[model samples]
Target: MFFIYSFTADTPPNICITGPYKTWRAVIPADTHSLSPVLYCSGCEDHVSVSADQPNSQMETDEPQSFFAAFCQLLFKSVRYICIYIIEFFTGPKQSLKGNHSDNKVNLVLLGMSGTGKSASGNTILGRRQFVSRTSSVPVTTECQVEETEINGTCVCVIDTPDIFDDEIESSVKNQHVTKCKQLLQSGPCVFLLVIQVSRFTDLERDILRKLEKAFGSKAKEQTVILFTRGEDLQCADMNLEDFLQDCNSDLKNIVDQCGRRCVVFENKTSHKHQVTKLMQKVDEMLNKQQNQ
Candidate 1:
């Protein structure tokens, strides 16, 4: 036996199924919208009328109509849902001007103590003088600043923050800076570039990870990467970063381990684009790992 179920208005009947048992076919007119083609093998004498509403309601059947009736009900529901999905897809509510996908930016924030090359690293990442970076004995960045550019088709927003947690900076000013940093990153995903001088990790920075966790919750380490500035130090040592870190002190190793061993090196004085590409790749890998979790 065979059966056909036609859905379209002008097209020929669509062959639905074939079986060895005798079958019955219900032909619905194109103009009629009440009941579409519904086929039942044994029970064809009585019409199975289905309302446009309540398509999944129990059908009148003496035999087991679970398969056939459920199929018909599912077909009706699928058509209705597909129509709704299409309508909503085209005429759905508009995204907020601020919440648009183009605004799905990623913030790469430079965070560390004073004189750790945070500002210079920001300039290196942006590939321009977005922040003031000069030979200054004092910290140049006094307030939180941000600059944006596109990288790998993603809007990369780099935020330069002052040495807020430094003892020289006032507590009230640090509080305000922290608030502003949160505001800048509230709209999108953010990763912390814990910038530090290659050979100049101070005791103050030993507790820097603790401070970050206290301020941004314990997950801060998960989103952080140890950015060793002044790659020349490693070059002068005649060693690559991985070898240097392996022989590095326990404190530095602890910091790296806390951040899931995520680390990258940068030479702010150089114009090497490959370094930026590699760093961005590490950032993407970190983000992907977080998402999978």
Candidate 2:
């Protein structure tokens, strides 16, 4: 018999089921903003008893272990349904949560169409202009480029890919770009940052996501986040980020939803390091959330 809990971006959700079978304790942390208020379904016929952890001693029936098993089955089913419900209910088509964390670790894959600030974000993350920057419209990233930098004592492998979604470009060039991204992901866990301008979001952004799905498979969805360039422009001393996102453009909102509502806007043209630190903090939060869940 078992019970399960799931996590989503909306609610500070994470639950751990521990202890002996019938006496197992469900720890719902203070920040867990659960979607449903009810955990113990009162209608189940498994001779089960339930009570709020805070309100009373657990309401336990003198039911057999097998009786608890039936209730456990119901509980497991509820958790499974809720997990998918949260993602589908709120998660957008373009953004998604990063995948499970393991000992494999993760690298960063900076991807997007030309002029979306991929190279700039890479430089901001690595604390240097590791790749060429230009004003021309043509995709300068003729091939895949790989570089590794350390951030906060962690090895940050940054891989830059050419515009794979470029239709006018040569097919060979596109395929080479895709190959580089894959090779990098193969080395370890990868966080693909879809760099884009903060001033605007467009259909081209969604189109790029579809291209990524085709080239890298759905697995990439879990490991991707939208890095909004020119974010420092939007920062406010009084307004919170949640408000900013709520008031953002539909395209921006869509991208935010895609990356599991995770965002880190930055001012790439400036020489501030706080933006990179914020990015690291977001990644670390993601890891810690997965671990606690």
Candidate 3:
């Protein structure tokens, strides 16, 4: 005869079965997060009494020793699979987590439409004019550029990409930009800074996020931070960044939510080192949370 049962760790395994046939009970460890139903069967062997405390005691069976070894192997394989599932549940997305930790550096990729102050934001973060930022009728940065600096005791490498999301741009040209961006990603943990102008959320800006997802896959936003430039707009209205976000349109809110609500504001015109410092703090927080998971 055979019997099967399941119980949580907190429950006392006080099961006692008696019959003319031999009886075997399998008790799962308490530390396991989940309980899988286990079956035990009596075999042609002498009857031996077992107590609840002695869960690991071997049950006499006329079956070959190899049969027991095979059963143990299958049980361990199931436990290992469960462990991997639990780990993936806690760690949300992996796009931002891939990198060699030995080379401690963070890659900050600046991406957005033309005239969105991406270059200026890069300059502000680096505390110097590393990229050409100027008022122009056309996209100032026609290619991807990179620069490095030390921020808050961490090495930061910023990549400035052109307005590759423009529909008018040829697909071949956009492919080239994408290729260059991938080549520039040979640093440590990376995060994309999706820059946009404050108080000027255009229709194109609304759709640019969708395009970003198409180009970088659905997990793109997991490693992305929505950076709103021209912070003076908020200051002039006596509103903080959160306050502004609370009143913004749903499109922007959805974008922020997709990125795990990781957003920051930067007044590129000002030289306030504190602003850069605050943004870096958000970046570090994201890194820490991802690493812990």
Candidate 4:
């Protein structure tokens, strides 16, 4: 007997097998848009019509491999490749007139106070775990660290910095971080990702941006993107991103306006696959607009 399920959906269907777990086949490609699972009992064998709008949930496997299992694996692998290609068209770099991947490379600097998930957003964009996060009462990132990664063959450099505006630091230490930022931007044109917690907005963020204004001039906002971390704060309720931002306090609006009205929300805890794609798409859209102008 076999049961097929998908892990990439919402409203995921879960069927209780009073007995034991069995191998399953996913009728549709596993993805974020998948709906809950629909179990096909071994005896029933009704060909369920999977809806494209329906999303599946993460599936759990408990049995050993079989010939059919191998075949199913190959099928899904092909589907994954296809999906990545199509999604890359939107979320990844754009193709050039010469049919080559476009090259309007930009360095992105992440700025925010401690515990704002700056590094986490960088890891999500780079498609790997490239930075660390801390939940301590005190700040952890002591120096600026730079890492280079690629998405759809476009090279990107992500610089993660310590809390430049941490209260514990003196002017000398603050300038050290400022120097590091210049070095990171040495490669070429760059953008900034201003991260802030979703639950609360603070004046400290604005004060830091004031310093950034001095460094990059008023143009920094044009190159900046506001990334709100810990999106799980809105997970339970049904809310749009704009509504979430509108509900923010005065301090948040000041920061948002400084970033040229560009913003992306992120959940650093769980891997909600599509969020990264959506974020990068917005990032590319901003860059593309700037290039055209």
**Maximum-TM-score candidate:** 1
Give model 3's TM-score versus the native structure: 0.64
Leading candidate by lDDT: 1
RMSD of each: 11.7, 14.7, 11.6, 19.2
The lDDT for every candidate, in the order shown, is 0.73, 0.63, 0.71, 0.64
Error of 4 at 226 (Å): 0.2
Q: Between prediction 3 and prediction 4, which has the larger TM-score?
A: 3
RMSD of 1: 11.7
Runs of candidate 4 with Cα error greater than 4 angstroms are 1-104
lDDT-best of 3 and 4: 3
Q: Write the per-residue lDDT of candidate 1 for residues 1-293, one digit (tens) a residue.
A: 34454444244232244445435444432333343445445444633443445745775556555565555556554455444444344445655322333344688988998888999888888888889988788878888998898776677889999886576667788889888988887466789999988888787777888888876778888899888988998999898999988998899889888888888899988989888888887887787676667
Clashes (candidate 2): 8
Candidate 4: tens digits of C-alpha lDDT, residues 176-245? 8978888877454577888888886666665767777765577877888888887888775566678887
Tell me how many residue pairs clash in candidate 3: 0
Residue pairs whose backbone atoms clash in candidate 1: 1-19
Worst 10 residues of 4 by lDDT: 10-19
The TM-scores of all predictions, comma-separated, are: 0.66, 0.58, 0.64, 0.61
Question: Which candidate do you rate higher for lDDT, 1 or 2?
Answer: 1
List candidate 2 stretches off by more than 4 Å: 1-105, 170-172, 235-244, 288-293
